[model samples]
Target: MNYPFCIRCGWVLALTFASCYPGLAQTPTPARDTSFTVYSALAKARKTDPSITLARPAVPTIIRSRMNVPYCTASGRALQLDVFYPKARRQGGYPAVLLIHGGGWRSGDRSQHVPMAQQLAARGFVAVTAEYRLSTEAPYPAAVQDLKAAVRWMRANARTYRINPKQIATWGFSAGGQLAALVGTTNEETRFDSLACNIGYSSQVQAIVDVDGILAFIHPESGEGDDRKSTSAATYWFGSPKTERPDLWRQASALTYVGPHTPPTLFLNSSVDRMHAGRDDMMRQLSQFNIYHEVHTFPDAPHPFPLFNPWFSPTLDYTVAFLNKVFSRK
Candidate 1:
């Protein structure tokens, strides 16, 4: 399979450097590339070389989510978000989409999702890439709480942002997908009050789009490190050993929140099975609930095919179509 050229370049550089330190004569190892990709979306996703970047869809305007606009506040730091919208205004404002980035719930920034938000904005949706606390920053439910607060913050200030609160949806990739699903399924049960921002607006989302996120984190065939208990993301993000906190682990799963009233969802997946543990079950549940849902599988694609070109167009099409249909019905 053809990979991004940037990855190939990184390998060449490493090999060249290795040859320079001939015979291991106590050569001091040069500094490692710090800003390279880590575990984003799926742990199996190949680490990207610095040059590779997501393709941006052309748009008339570029908007920032604003640096450190506290969706919620904590002793350490405040949560933030990035907003992207069309330059031309719509009559009744634009339908809002909150985008969440993936980094195995441990590492990632809202900046990674700007290209996607721009694409969505190009398609006429007011999109915001929401930031939440990482596992390193806090732990389970902290990220979830931050995301819920972000929704509330957006809805509470819909008029100022020219948003259609009734048509808001949560869209996330990989780990973010897991959070998005949680947000959609548990819309009826949980919501965090926006701190120092919107106080009373509801955090409920009308639709959801999960791009190859972990559907169930407690599966036997857990993807990353050796097993389920050892999987860095599943274990680290829970902030406990899986064996000791099975109940809490399950509670944190997106599939656990699935219920009769879960909003219409669109799931897109790569051919990889590592991250898509309980997709069939989630789909079955959605079908049984009679909720409008759709699933698409990209053949032989890697962990995050949606973020790049060639496949990005199709991915964007499915997302836009699903959002338009579901939001129109609402």
Candidate 2:
């Protein structure tokens, strides 16, 4: 089938599904280099909506700058990942954190998550910020596949990057948070089994840091949410609406996959976001699974607040501490 084209950028996006597992020669295609610059995009997004603001770190980076690297291939398309690691501390391999960006599975870029990635890296972890296939080009699990491939790629190249292959964590904001939760909750016996290049390493994350990400597609309310927008996210990430694609929706839901072995998780949100129901539902599920999790509900923080404003720093501090605690253990 012919690939689709982006309306704004006129970028041709191929949607073919060939195995992107390691060892296969990557099918090459035109590189998508038009990703939004994180700083520029934030400034523009804030201009349209003053509620959004970029939060800067109080101190300078103790780590090296970003490393732009391609982590996956799909339909001849190359998806890139950016790595932020410590240049000063190189004696030992660091615990790793993969930062996924949120764009409703449609927009946003790796740069948007660079600050958080750098923050983690500066805190003694190898930070990997990745790009995935967007909904505008390919729908459903393509983005998930991109994330899976990134995990595989990181494991494959661990030594060179000074990373501990097993000490990996996935953290995301919004849609990316959902993806991180998906990685945290899923087991090797599920669909992800086929994608694992070798059983020696696992993609199960040590912890999941979710920032206002959706947990379940089974919206308890009827006609309450902006169906037009919500369904767009569901359809773009699950290939169909929750009603029509119950099975796939169930499979895709991170909440549904939580079990006794689920990695510990942290959720940050505010009362303003409509994800309260989903978040509550996820908490209940996690409780049932006996999973360890903590939720920080900012009084009036908006969605994507951490990346947008200074008020979100406390949450980032919590994230660094959470990483330190989780990685410090066996």
Candidate 3:
């Protein structure tokens, strides 16, 4: 018997089984390059502005780190994360933040954010840098599921890491920023949670830090599906052009999930307007719900400003202040 499959994700839709067990059918892995890194981003950014330099990872003596800790297993692969915390812990445990890297969803790894994580750790937060399956390995929801699983893992082992699980935040840059916003906005939404990891723990985050991440793939300001020249990153992740798989594009958008329950968010954007897609709308929704939020745009900064020096310091400062303000109230 020929079974129906989802054209968007290439998952076989065994209707009877899928309805009963939503997480049973995993997204098919696709062949793609995963070479984009902090160096690659720096190289590209330097072309536009030669003054830009890559942020090097530096573990201060005041910070303690555990490298390559397994967070969860997905599709028979162990997803690992690196944890950085202060040697001097807070009384009720330090607030935590998960840092995600941006590489258009096709490339980039957790190590890209190590510098920022170490800085956060030194500044009094338990920072975690996580590796999520990219578009090359699995499409769309796989990255989201992996990130949520990481949050669950953090919560489950909060005591061991000296983390205040209730005061966690998700922070991302570019593609990661989008994922961070999606994870923060979709709090308590079990559909995105994976059954294979930390089943009883919550993936809820108290704050979100989106640095130059597009909030919507289908919004008017979005340049996601304009692939006349070549296949766009959104196309690669969704496994189809936005025109063909608009449902997937919409579903993956963090704006689609914004509502009263959405947590306070900090939007650190560059001069690129396209990167700000759905941000204003999301802010409007948050305002309607009386939620706390902040937006700051560096006048002429590039999209990867979070990875460079002049802008990186301010980016870190804004993030620290936002997380402190949001968690201080709690």
Compare the candidates by lDDT and give the number of the best one: 3
- Tens digit of lDDT per residue, candidate 3, span 82-177? 999999857779999999988888677888889999999988999999999876566678899999999999999999999998899999998999
- lDDT for each residue of candidate 2 in 1-330, tens digit (9 for 90 to 100): 011222321122222222221211124344443334456546665765677667766534477754667666674767788887877655558888888887666667777777777777777888899888775566567677678778778887887678888788888877787788887778454466444343355566678888767776566731222345323444434444455557876676787776778887888875545553367777877788887778888775655566777555687788888878777775
Off by over 4 Å in 2: 1-52, 58-61, 89-92, 193-201, 221-231
State candidate 2's TM-score. 0.80
Per-residue lDDT tens digits for candidate 1, residues 147-194, read 888898888777777798888899998888888888888887744333
lDDT of 3 at 176: 93
In what order do the candidates fall by lDDT, top score first? Answer: 3, 1, 2
- Candidates sorted on TM-score, descending: 3, 1, 2
**Local error of candidate 2 at residue 225 (angstroms):** 8.1
**Total backbone collisions, model 1:** 2
What are the models' TM-scores? 0.80, 0.80, 0.89
Model 1 root-mean-square deviation: 9.4
**Candidates' lDDT values, in order?**
0.70, 0.67, 0.83
Clash list (residue pairs), candidate 1? 65-82, 65-83
Query: Which residue pairs collide in model 2, if any?
Result: 53-308
